[model samples]
Target: MGLQTQLRRAIAVYRFVALGYPVLLGALAFDALQRPVAAAALVALLIGWTAAVSYRYTRNGYEPKVVYTDLAVTAAAVALSAWALAVSDRAWPISLGPWLAGIVLVWGAAWGRRSGAVAGGVIAVFGMVFRGGINENTVNEAALLVLTGFTMGHLVRLGVEAEERTRRATERDAAARERERLARDIHDSVLQVLALVQRRGNEIGGEAAELGRLAGRQEEALRALISSEAYRHPLDGRRDLRELIGRHAGESVTVAAPATPVRLPTATAQEVAAAVASAVDNVREHCPDGTRVWLLVEDDGEAVTVSVRDDGPGIAPGRLAAAAAEGRLGVAQSIEGRVRELGGTVQVVSGPGQGTEIEMRVPRPREGDADGDAHRGR
Candidate 1:
């Protein structure tokens, strides 16, 4: 549908047409050398067929049906060549042209190496049968044709694969640019206003103070959401679990993690971090003032688990389901969504008048897993 795609189809059609020219020439030559009257008539017929097929293909814009018709034409040409070789005295040499032409057809069509190899084998068999013996020159010609066909076919296949990869890369780059643009626009306009409101409300007491606190919380969440660092660039240096948790700890918040490093995918780490932050925010919102929050990270080799617990009022029965129904979907979208996207799971244990505990478990990469490098490349 795109210009490049249309061009590629046109190129394929042209290659198909161009390949037939040599076969047509060889067919006419064979007829002239062996049957003069038939040679003239066959040449006329070839011209007419070629013109008709070309017109149909050009008009159809290289539809699959039109392409198949061209393939039928090639098959007919191959049949005609075989018939001529069977009847002619100089069948051995004359057959080589058609064999080479068949190889060209297979290669130009972008069939894989196996298809070309199969064509080579069939032609070689016919050559040996027609000549009644294998000679050095015949064997050499066969080998050359086979190699040429295989190489050309592979080259075409590689070109197609490379083109496809380029197209996907282009699309991905475009999408990334769009996301970055949206992030910038949100930060410039909405985030700036939120920040101003939060700061102003903090100065003015009463209802404005409550609004300011809410604005501040929202601003923090938005900042975390839009921060490129939170996305965890693969090329950036890795951080140990202890260091990562410590960075988020506060005077009222205690972090407990293993001393040793727990390697993880960048995405996995970021999601876990965001989930921890969300859990912390929820505890602050629902718990008694000045209640302590504890963060724990455990690395069990097979999986890494992170838990955020607060001795605060826990969720009531059916509260989560009710919240979801009411479109209060922050926890579901922010925490659960993040964990699920990383191929991990999240569990919440809570009850009315009790404490809340949020646990997230992410599977560890196996030894020598290719995904280790994939994370490093993120």
Candidate 2:
């Protein structure tokens, strides 16, 4: 059952003990007949306290002041019971112990160990002091009050912590399942179309041959991305950007980065890496097969900078604008769009013979920053 439910049941049990205490005390105190007025007043207070406790705490909500009130009333009642017994002619001690002890246990269960200890300590100390000296019964009652309050408080805290851990685990599991479902969808449709375009374009020959090769390269990149450990791992929104970027380095591609790790939120790092990969793919499709491409990663603890440069023939004037107008969006959607979503800037420099250099810069998000997704199509 839930922690609240358990506590309500415990409150009911304490209330039951409280209801019986006055009647039990009347029977035990043979001097009760001698001090009729004091006996009646004490009994009346105990009965009223029991009803108040039940009405305030048995259901859902209760104010913090109610607990303090209960403590004050309990302390007063214990003191008065001792006074009533001392004035009576009877030599017997009345067992008014249960009323205070029950309240201490309830406080402990409600507020945890420290609150419990305070409430329990007050009752135990006051009870012993009013009785004159510390005896075996006094020591046992004090020990019982301390132990019950602290133990119940600990149990309540443990239950709360366990529930929190379960909630986080459930969220992680659900996120992982959602990612797998999306990967399947992308593989079944987008990846297949890219692959088919590559194969058919190659068979058609001429200008279509170059277009097909570009599509083929993109298809391979997408396949590797979807199957990568970085993609398959749970989306925690934090990861090492250095690891993701390093995956693109092989053969004609060279990666230069610091020895230390470059960490970033998972979505931001992935989008940056995807943008760099798209730039490299452009180099392979347009430049010679053996052309060298250099990728540099730098992080100065404020922002991340990535530069992709290739020693290949650069684009002529107005080529990018012309391509955008014709609805070709590889550079727009794949690179610029991704970085823009991350609240960053991108610069592209190329001339007829100066080769191509694309630089992307994104600031490191502030700690506990409440931003949304850094890029779409994750």
TM-scores of the models, in the given order? 0.65, 0.63
Q: Write the per-residue lDDT of candidate 1 for residues 1-378, one digit (tens) a residue.
A: 543344445544554465465455565665545544444454455557656755554455446555455555554554554444343545343343532444343433334565555556555555555554588755875686577657655765666556655665675567567767878998998899999998899899888987888778677766665664433232232435454455567777999888778766544565677777777877767676677899999999988899988888789988988988999876798888888877789898989877888898878655534233211211
| Cα lDDT computed for each candidate against the true fold | 0.63, 0.77
Give stretches of model 2 more than 4 Å off. Answer: 1-5, 18-22, 28-63, 83-111, 131-133, 204-218, 235-245, 250-378
Query: How many clashes in candidate 1?
Result: 1
Instruction: Pick the TM-score winner.
Output: 1
- Supply candidate 2's per-residue lDDT for 236: 64
Output the worst ten-in-a-row residue range by lDDT, candidate 1.
369-378
Taking the tens digit of each residue's C-alpha lDDT, what string does model 2 give over 1-378? 666567767776776676576566675655545665777777777787777676777665345788788888888877787766443654434647666667776777677777787788888887787765488877888888888778767776777667655765687678778878888998999889988888899899998888888888777777777787787774565778878888777888899998998888777888999899889988887787677899999999989999999888888889988888999888888999999999888899999878899999999998655234222111
